[model samples]
Target: MTRPSLLAAIAIASLSTITTGAFAADQLVVASFGGAYTASQSKAFIEPYMAEKGAKVLTADYNGGLAELRSQVQSGNGAWDVIDLELQDALRACDDGLIEKIDASQLAPAADGTAAADDFLPGTLMDCGVGTIMWSNIIAYDKTKFQNGGPKTIADFFDLEKFPGKRGLSNKPNVNLEWALMADGVPNDKIYETLATEEGLNRAFAKLDTIKKDAVFWGAHAQAPQLLADGEVVMTAAANGRIYDAISKEHKPFEIVWDGQIWNLDVWAISKASKNKDAALDFVKFSTTGPRLADVTKYISYGPVRKSSQGLVPEAIRTNLPTYETNFKTSLANDLEFWADHQDEINQRWATWMAK
Candidate 1:
């Protein structure tokens, strides 16, 4: 996929704006995390697949569809052909037989100029669900507060006396719990293992208690960046992409401390009863292939799923991309299994935590 071809792909995608008329009334309704990000996905893969397979693609929201999926499965009328879910959501969906097992061999092979899925980070690409985007809950700080130097680690987040201010924290246990445990003396390497223990969760909450009344619990992605940019909070947990956007716009001394950041793995899974399974699979294959993925990341600033996408970027810009192995080395992968098993209990605790 060269620059010209990339443009051609976008043009084809733009024309696909036509109402998937009767040529193929069949539709593959997808439940996903919808945003401008999905637009990039539509241009890069969905439209291409629609044109080639003569199929209709419908979009739906994921949070609203879980109950619908449960009901549809009971009725034996599953409507979704594919789902774009967070890592843990995909795992839970797979367990409930809401999705089908994917065969990697059926996907497009990486050859010559075409970027292939194999070029992705090992273990991130899967037989069924593949990670589509990379995001991290990194340490975002006010540059003006520390113009000469800024807070750099989980320890700094805990160090109120040295670099203290109102902090923004995710209400969820995934990243916040990990950050909490990290604050309580858990090594980055041992963060997840610590989280598996009763003491670890308690310890994490206890650490958070130190700043509880002062912490602003952002309920959505948009909130954290807005809070930081508006000085609603000085240092806090933030998504890397949003943090970057704020830094670029605010021109404030905002900087991200990647150390001990929690990585969010957004993954894609295909429906078991998809009408266009082959083409759906092709879409997945095309979406995650390194070159197209690289292009998507270059445009969106979200980390690419492929390991080699980092190479596609210029040396200077590579630092901003999460494809770099060093970035992966520093960030902790979310404990999807832990979250899957304890989501109910954790939700209760989070609710209690929030009530205070």
Candidate 2:
């Protein structure tokens, strides 16, 4: 071949290499709490987005917290482009400038053309993050554990003489404090207000003290269901989705007690330091559409945050969601603002209580 022809061939090869390198770098890394929750997201969001956009996606799982996200941001080498955060963590991360500010205007509207901002449930759309799903923490008991009707209320959870078995509780103080306050006779509307004072704090701990010895504390989402399945704890505080998966898929004889259930939102936020910020934001937009949000319910029991998505969910799945009328009757929405202000102090106290 002539020298000119050889040069042309070399140029084509170099261009192909550059294009491949750029395409590889365009992939987005998303992080979230693992287990059935992530599985639902994989089916409902990630896989579909990749297929539609021809983009590469990677996933990382972390038991929920701000420590790993903080480390990544502070070090200026963020490994995750998109992160799924509990509402309080999202608030704190946004305040500390750890995540990118999202523009709600860019989100897709409802099928009927309602604005995205107005379509989302109140308190879900934030400056830095967009809410994805609403999930709840509730008491799950083995149906076979008690011949008599099992725990029926939050108060029953603390009654050792009546329930007569080891209890499973999350190691975190968030829901436990609220449940303690509720079980101790504080009214639902007064829960956070009651927990704000010194006397209230002591009262919660004192109520918790009633079952500390018999309580088995679990730190991860999966552990709650496993504790009950393994018979380590007769009843455990579990994510509703996890318990639903165990019952529906594994055919476990577990039942969820929705009384005094504490529900919260999981938000999607972009890392401030992500090299793929644009791609990350695009994925977030795509995943949060009403159709996509509703699709998640087909896999897990979590309720979609979009008001429009509610209609998309079938009646069978809708009835099992946390937002279902019967299930939500006695539920309490977690106060993200309260946790944002009090998490550090509460965590410190939680550690002390755990030690004792």
> How many backbone collisions does model 1 have?
1
- Candidate lDDT scores, in order, read 0.66, 0.87
By TM-score, how accurate is candidate 2?
0.92
Please list the residue runs of candidate 2 whose C-alpha ends up more than 4 Å from where it truly belongs after superposition: 1-25
In TM-score terms, which candidate is top? 2
lDDT of 1 by residue, 271-334 (tens): 7656555555556666676666666654445777666665676665567755456665666766
Model 1, residue 254: displacement in angstroms?
Answer: 3.2
Worst 10 residues of 2 by lDDT: 12-21
Q: What tens digits encode model 2's per-residue C-alpha lDDT throughout 1-356?
A: 01111112211011110011123337899998888999999999999999988899989999988899899998989899999998778878877989887767778889999989889877787778889999999999999999988889999999999889999999999999999999999998889888989899999999999999999988899899899999999998999999999998899999999999888889999988788787888888899999999999988999999999999999999989999999999888787667766888999999999998
Could you list the CA RMSD of all candidates, in the order they appear?
8.2, 12.4
Lowest lDDT block of 10, candidate 1: 10-19
